[model samples]
Target chain A: MSRPTRTTEESIARVLPELDYSKIALSLVVMLFFAFFVSPIWTGLVTAFKTTGAVTATTPFVPVLPGTEGFTLAKWTRAIGYLSTGFVNSLAMTIPATIVSVFLGSTAAYGLTLVDWNERLQFGILILFIAGIFIPYQAVLVPLSDFWINLVPLVDILAPVWQLPFLEPDHARLLSLTITHVVYGIPLCMLLFRSYYLTLSDELVEAAKIDGATISRIYRRIILPLSKPMIGVVFIYQFTAIWNEFLFSLTLIGSSSSPAATVTLVLSGMGVDLSGIDFGFRMAGAFVAAMPTLIIYVLFAEQFARGLAEGNT
Target chain B: MAGSQDTATGSRTIGGGETDWRTRVETFSKSDFVRSFPYWFVPFSLVGMGVYGGIGWNTVISLTDYEGFDRPDYTNLDFSMYAQALSDPWVYLTAKNTLVLLIAFTTITLVLGLLLSILLDRGIRYKEKIQTIYLLPMALSFVVTAQFWLWMYNVNNGLVNAVVGVFGLGPFNWIGNPDLVLGAVIFALIWQYSGYAMVVFLAGLQAIPDDQFEAAHIDGAGVFKTYWRVIIPQLKSSSVSAAVVLMVFALKAFTFLYAMFGQYRVPKATDILATLMVREAFMLQHWAYAAAIGTILLVMALAVVAPYLWYQYGQGSL
Candidate 1:
């Protein structure tokens, strides 16, 4: 019986073909999906490398293969030179804002757990932070702009009387933008750290409590060390977010002629010229602007992906 | 000394030997509540004032008829801005566009993302590499995506036209034609966002047990049937979360369009409430009217979120 079964299996294997149409079709579908997602960026890269005249004349989808006349560094030079101020401004705004917001969020998250508050109050505050996640940035646009515009005059008036260094009118936009981003960042970072801390066992906190460590002491010594991974996660998340943020940057920091406007604003501003828009230069600038985040993403794709996924829930 | 001792002893005895109120107050200052309060105060107040407070202020501004380089008059408040917005023809057009974007973008992205997730989950070779490729665009700023797609959707020399022209189709105007601009914008947004939906759906798919697939196979179900009946139904939570995020982002498409066109005043065909709000406020200086539009948009956003919040509340995760 075993021999017959083996012979049957051998006969089936011999009769069947290796080639499968379904597999081919599925492979084609997946390939198409990938091509659909990748084509635009691939074209952007190709166009960025091409001369301005070549970009307009040649099909964007076609790559400038080696030994081609399409390649040019002119666009890159022009784009970088144009965007240098915005690049510096983005770094200036993003670095301090990201660090401060993440630090504030982590501390607040730790305090939230340690506070011996009423359950309803604690839950209410947590909900407030969560609710901030869904509030359309538009909802805040008018009032925030209103606040900043009004505060500038106050600063100018008070600076001379108080014998203090007044915020320069030009730097007002920068100050307001940094403050707005830092404040807006608190909710998401706090939520991320809160959820992260929730997963940790509190035996360490309890042990510290028995040793007469105060709430701040326990958090400083025990929770902070244990929270290194989460701190990195929150830091990367906030850094990416504040770095890429557009609407707030656009609304708050519009063309201050200083290190205030973000690279995104510069990239978008490139499109404003109706007749003289250079596709090569614009694409090159975009590639330049996106380089930092893209490099960070390549290095920490898993953590970035995980943080975003966890953040929404 | 005798008087102080008598008062302390009287209070202690009267309070059934518990510490007096003043001593309890001192001890409370050393408790976790006092220690932790200072830590939470700055973030909570800042977020509260910046976000919720802004919303409150926006609502107030919408109630007045303030516009064009003037402080909002706090004396008289009414819904005239909302009433005016309700009657405006532009408002109607933008509202229709917003609804179209929200529904169309969310549905298409969710379906495509689910398809990709299923394809990847079925033991595909180089799955990680493929996912990373699909997801790489998500890491890009909206400005980049907007500019990239603007170039791609160019009529004559764009890659989109280039690909289709090979099949004997002539180049079509993508961003130029009013009827096609919204679709083009939605397509670009979906391209940038579907990877996110796929990651979400993939996470959901992985959470299901393998025994369910074997059980379906044993029951003589085909590949399509197993996923359609057993697996896809289980992805409801993932779908809900992805849809909410997508729809919320759909409302935010103002930034994408503004970036693409490089101005607050986008094409009338593509203007959603967000773009309209910005244009009305900054360009035209119809501050109160813009605030009214913002209020409406907020209501729409909250409508999308209310159900999710209710679901979480029901689950006791609120």
Candidate 2:
């Protein structure tokens, strides 16, 4: 949809009247308002000090400050034992998936907007990508997962390069999950890139072409360099999305007792197995596992702002 | 190859024609490849074809009983799955919960985002820093935020209890008990998403000129009247934008619930449709039944959103 266009005269004339004060009073209620985000888990960071009795003693209440004045690393030590392998498993899933999806997504977007492809083919693929967004992952998970498991043999036979990184070939299960996540991310990546690309002058692209730059070379030498901000934004979006993914990892890795699981699957396992329901440790583990995403946010806030701003959703 | 050799022999430059022919062949191949990029790019369109085919198939899948690798018995399938999914007290309750969370989160996020945008617009000092800090959660994944909150919401050692301890209150069961689980999840959503909505509103607010506010000020227009009669109406698009996004997010929330509540949390209590479909169908392997729930969910989302989309389209056309 087009952005609504308003004339300056109309804009001023409309605002000729003032607004109500009480209408936005809640805005000024900083303590209570900010509390919405902060209050929910405000004391979680400090609660690392309390003994288990002191913890469970509160029943369901979270302590703003635990009774134990001194800190204890017991939870940390225990958490490592509980979730370390899971953390490695999750990383193994996220890192490669994030890299591949970002590459494929940008390529699709570039091809659609910058490179001239058949018009119907362009929209067809674009729509294909878009349509996947609305379909719940659950609807496709079963067939899709099975499709991945089934793909292992075919990939080995047809695309041997896929075998180089995938030595076991059985681990193609992870690659299957990766493909699905990548496929899901395609539309969004294309939408973001194409929108941003629209803002760039075609003269720039033509200029690069005049210098005898190959299509791929022009993309690397020119477009890629110019698109750093958007790249950062895409990176953050994909990083968080792929990193925090739960179900695929759970199904592929966690459900089996092959002594392997992604962090999400393990973290989920924590929730499942929690008879005492270790909220403190579980939450801690969740945060620790999610640290990479948090770090990306802190590091690249601007990229996220610009990138998400143009998200087609 | 022979024709190129004949041209080389006919070259007035004699034997040097061979070198020229080689160069000509090299340039021709290079240019031909360059000119043929449009063809080389065809394979990539497969991604789109794959996507579109997926859409068609998913639509069909939603309607059928084809569960994963299991052979489907579509003939036996009717509205049984859909009816059961809809009739299930849990589905109904979760639908209600979903609606409540959508409204609460959207309303809260929209209001706060609008206010934050306006506050920053009014030239709040350190505006940029606050904006970044606020937007930090938006950048963080839902899973990360959920996990972070899972820690923060921990009863025994959670920061909430620690803070409340001085006030002489016990730690509340944030994710554990069914009573507060929905609220906890909602809080998690707001924390992560409000900043996202705020940035959108802020961008819209930026596009709004200062002259309008100034004119309202000179006209004896109080802040409220200016905002109510002027600002609010103008922000209709932004409001719709925020509402639409928040609604979709609430509807699609899986990671948050799954991370916090686990798969089997009492179905009716905290189970959103997305999670319910997977929990029942995939986890429980109730293939036909889960497919039914998924179909219902697809219908529900479209039923709720399709109207708004059409309405937006009509308004845009006008």
Q: Which candidate leads the pack in lDDT?
A: 1
Candidate closest to the true structure, highest DockQ:
1
For the record, the alpha-carbon RMSD of candidate 1 to the native fold, in angstroms, is 5.5
Residue B283, model 2, lDDT: 65
Q: Fnat for model 2?
A: 0.25
* TM-score of predicted structure 2: 0.77
Candidate 2 achieves a global lDDT of 0.62
- Runs off by more than 4 Å, candidate 1: A1-23, A65-67, A114-116, A152-169, A256-259, B1-19
**What's the TM-score of candidate 1 when only chain A is evaluated?**
0.85
Give the 10-residue window scoring lowest on summed lDDT in candidate 1 chain B. B1-10
Error of 1 at B98 (Å): 0.1
Put down candidate 2 lDDT per residue, A1-313, tens digits, no spaces.
1112223223334455323343244346543445555544344444444455555555333443534433356666776777787677667777776776666667666766676546666555555455455555565554454444553444455566545652444455555666666666665666676677778888886776666566677678888888887777777777777777776676654363334466666666664463766555655665567667767777777776766666733
| Interface RMSD values, listed in order for every candidate | 7.8, 6.9
Q: For candidate 1, lDDT tens digit of each residue in A1-313? A: 0112232222233434433545577689889988989899988988988887788878787877656787888888998988887887788888899999998898888878654466678877888888888888877788788888874544464455434354345555666788889999998898888888888877767767777778888878888888899888888778888878888877777652444568888888874655766888989999988887888888888777777777776
